[model samples]
Target: MTAHYKNIVVHLPNWLGDTMLALPFLHGLRSVFPDARITAAGRLWVSDILHHFPPLDAVASISSTSGLINYLRGEKFDLGFLLPNSFRTALAFKLGRVPERAGYALDMRGILLTHPLKLTDAIMRESMVEYYMRLLEPFADISEIPRIMKLYPDEADRAEARRVFLENGWDGSSKLVGVNPFAFQWDTKRWLPERFAEVADRLAERYGVRCVFSSVEKDRPLMEKIKGMCRRPIIDLVGKVPLKILPAFMEHLSLFITNDSGLMHVAAAADIPIVAVFGSTDWQRTAPWSQKATLIRRQQDHEPCMKPTCSRDFRCMNDISVDEVFNAAEKYL
Candidate 1:
């Protein structure tokens, strides 16, 4: 027999980084409704970290017009929480004929959402995760929501990481440092590759820490840039390590330094000290996670960059010198 209120839809954010940041909210939702079925609806490519999470009952990867909408409608969710502010996400529930729908009132999507929360003056905030949490724990007190971001890597994942490292001649004794140089989404988010390389080299030579670089297949060219700039050698695992190994690799690292990207957030969730180089994005709004993280940003110019593209000649990131990054990394050292 079909269950009653047995299915629910959770529309996730498009970005990988934001999804991990919403851990607290996700947990809150799960806590509130243990009986109701929870189905996370979003793209599959962005679910590298989320899939590892045990709390989520299921994730629906829907992107195409026919398949995406059809799958969402077919789920038969009793209620739906549209985390994404896009009209399409809200519209899906309406089309699905779901009994209840709730979301933030944005992009003229208020009418689509049955439970549209009223918006006050747009006050600035810190971090994308916090923004997500606020939207999640609405109606009740916002401050009560705990800002917790954590990742649980199982024995198999850790074992796999160890096996990969062992086959490649790693004994788990070497201090692991993660370096991410590519910011695919925005140019302004990318600090100079040479600058990042310099700091990575310093960390390796001065502290005897092993450097590990993370990048996408296309961003492999940036790895070359970092390799050329650094005096000390680094392990370039851009296309080498499989996706499953990413979490364990990140967990193995003592520190992670990168631009505003998903890998940075993963490192933070793994509880590894992270140093994020911020330019166009606001450090306050999207800094790593907590005080344990060191955020290097240029507040002097382009304070809170809501722009997806840069118009300031990369002034925001350019102002952040190699010295600043190295100094921040040194704190964790």
Candidate 2:
């Protein structure tokens, strides 16, 4: 018998890319329980990004485990899905007295869950989209998990995007290419900024397109460095655009060149053509889940180092040349 849920609360992942990859799982949950009220609970940025998203009825920003437990108790949710693998989140759900809790058995939290699935090696090898989809197997058919990832950008977001374009002197007809040079905190994942500048310049020279760069406030200096290296002027939107407005802003882009970072997944959600560079991370597991994306990763003789920071001169990223990335971008142009 298929169990029916009335009030469901899902604890979303912390990282942006992981949250985006979980969209297919959210869709499956909605399909199985069309009448149920689904709530998404996560960090503030996660809540902001998911605000007004179709699958969720409410978005809660959690500050602490104790606070989350208190909120969960007040909601009296019948079912809770723990998407994050942290033991702390699982404990919160268990203590909050949710009637049912479902999640993978990793992080030693299996004892806390009402429904715990084992984390097999094969599932570990699967892509992140498929990894999240596994959580729906006991409730829904797993053979055909939805592959399409979507985001809703409101009118305000569109307006902000338009304002930035106009301020940057975009003619509205010329193609705009987005270049993202920084990868969150992972130094090993980022390719050379000078190479990025070269690719941006070449793409503009060849296609007569305009290159626009964006990142968080902390990465502004690096974005400026790349902009300075480019012979042709590039529009720098770093620190000016918010996470909620990125999807709307990305819609104006013809092509996105980025490292294996959150913006790479954002570009995928925007359904834009992408040239994603990967190093130190397994491309098979975290590559952009878009048919329009072309991945450029040097085939390392050894396994992926999978380190947050590299000491060996970052050969994995350095091995990929500027010409390689530009050629990949050409396919989409």
Candidate 3:
């Protein structure tokens, strides 16, 4: 059977935030290849967020590299977009015999890609969304891009969100404010939980909004500590909501206040107003891509670097007070 450039595979970014940032690229790809069948392959947790993504005909979780390549060999994908810079990703496409593959020439994988793009240092400094969007330039004519991150939670997802809201006894009259206190995988990016507690307290007491704390199962201990510190009522949804259902859950929120974590991007994709607190991470590179977002970050002595752990006195995050976040939240609440 000869391939007709109909089956296309996109190797999605692994991180949740990066995955969310890739939506615009996927949208552009769909526009460019309207008749082509697009399959997004990634970890189950990462691609689960795109359960309602319209551009994708299917979402397949890649559990093993060899398994993926073997599967692709049979399917005969004509073109591939290797979004992840890992050499393994390019190798998979190369071995799978995807005739046309395009990606950044990083991780020494340029030889594997048929269309390897060399991004300049200046281009690397742009927002992750823009960086991802640039990848589609070779495949499509992208004139204008939408800044607002978008997610499509179906009617069933919306119904589930409403059910959870009712079960939590959330009053429809009162605005819902989401507080995510943990920043996964980076210690320097996390602001003090006490600060988040204070901000959640103020949102409830002063703004008259119902505050909900959202976090993954691993961050439960931190969530508990923040919950203990708070004086006002806070509904704990930690570890309960699945990633696929999170967009629906976020739909109930009027505003989301969070550390520069994956959920921050999720909130933005859900189109809820966000107050994202940045610490050591450069807001320019990874801030929530939403016009309604208010970024609260203290100025650093030096330009932000990609150091996961802070070498300096963690003043960048420590200096961002509860008042600043509360003030930002006031705009939406």
Candidate 4:
């Protein structure tokens, strides 16, 4: 029998990409408890991006453990879900006095959860979308989980995206290709700036499409480096576009070429055709969960390094040629 949950609180994932991947789980939760008031608690940025998402009734910006506990206590949540596999998060839920808690039994937090699901090696090998969907098994049929990830962009978001495009002189006559040259977590995951520049220029020359570059504030220097290397003029929107408006902005893109990064998932959710470059990270686990997406990674005799940082001179990324990436993008264009 399905448990009765009136006021449910879910601790969302910390990373933007993982948070996007959790859409299916959220969908499943809402399906099983249609009338429940579901609140998503996570970092401030996560709350900001998911503010307009329909599945969530409210978004709580969790700053510290004590603050999260206080907020959860004040809300009197009947049930809680921990998307992040951290002992601290489970402790917060327990101390917050949530009656029922469900999550994977990883990090030795099994005792804290009322429904502690096992985390298996097979589940670990599955795509992140599937991995997150597994969390719904106790409450609903896993097969019912939504395969397609989506983001709801409001009218203001669309207007902001339009304003950025117009200010950047995009006339909407030609196709716009987005190139993201930097990865947030790992330098090993990034393709060379020169290669990215070459691919951007080649795509422009071949398809008559304008290349638009994007990244966060900290990665602006890398975007600048790529822009300097490119022979063609590119629209650089690094640090200018807000996270909330990214999905709307990506909807205008014909194609997105990027590393296995947060924006790659955003583009995938936006339904943009993508060519994602993969390196040290496990591509199978985190590949864009979109049919329109194409992944490019070098074949290796050994397993992927799977490290945050690489010491092997980033051979996996370096081996993937600009021609290969351009050809992948060409198929979409």
Question: What TM-score against the true fold does each predicted structure earn?
Answer: 0.90, 0.97, 0.95, 0.97
Number of backbone-clashing residue pairs for each candidate, in the order shown: 1, 0, 0, 0
Residues 275-321, candidate 1: write the lDDT tens digits.
Answer: 88877766665677755788777765446666777766777778888
The parts of candidate 2 lying over 4 Å away from their true place are 1-3
lDDT of each: 0.75, 0.88, 0.85, 0.88
Lowest lDDT sum, 10 consecutive residues, model 1, at 118-127
lDDT of 2 at 143: 84
Pull out the clashing pairs in model 3: none
Which residue segments of model 3 deviate by more than 4 Å? 1-4, 144-148
In Å, residue 273's CA in model 2 sits off its true spot by 0.6
Q: Tens digit of lDDT per residue, candidate 4, span 1-333?
A: 554678999999999999988887888888888989999999987767888989889998989999999999999999899999999999999999998999999999999999899998899899988888887777888885567588989999999898998799688677899998888878878888899999999988888899999888898777767778989989988888888898899988999999999999999889889999998889889999899999999877554888777766677877899889888889998
Worst 10 residues of 4 by lDDT: 301-310
Task: Kindly list the per-residue Cα lDDT of model 3 for residues 1-333, writing each as its tens digit.
Answer: 123569999999989989988877888777778888999999887988888888899988878899889978988889999889999999999999999899999999999988888989897789888888787777655666444467889998888777777677676667888888888788887888898899888878887888998778898988888878999988888887778888898988899998889899998888899999888788898988888999988776674756789878888888888788888889886
RMSD of 3: 2.2
TM-score of 1: 0.90
Better of 1 and 3 by TM-score: 3
Residue pairs with clashing backbones, model 2: none
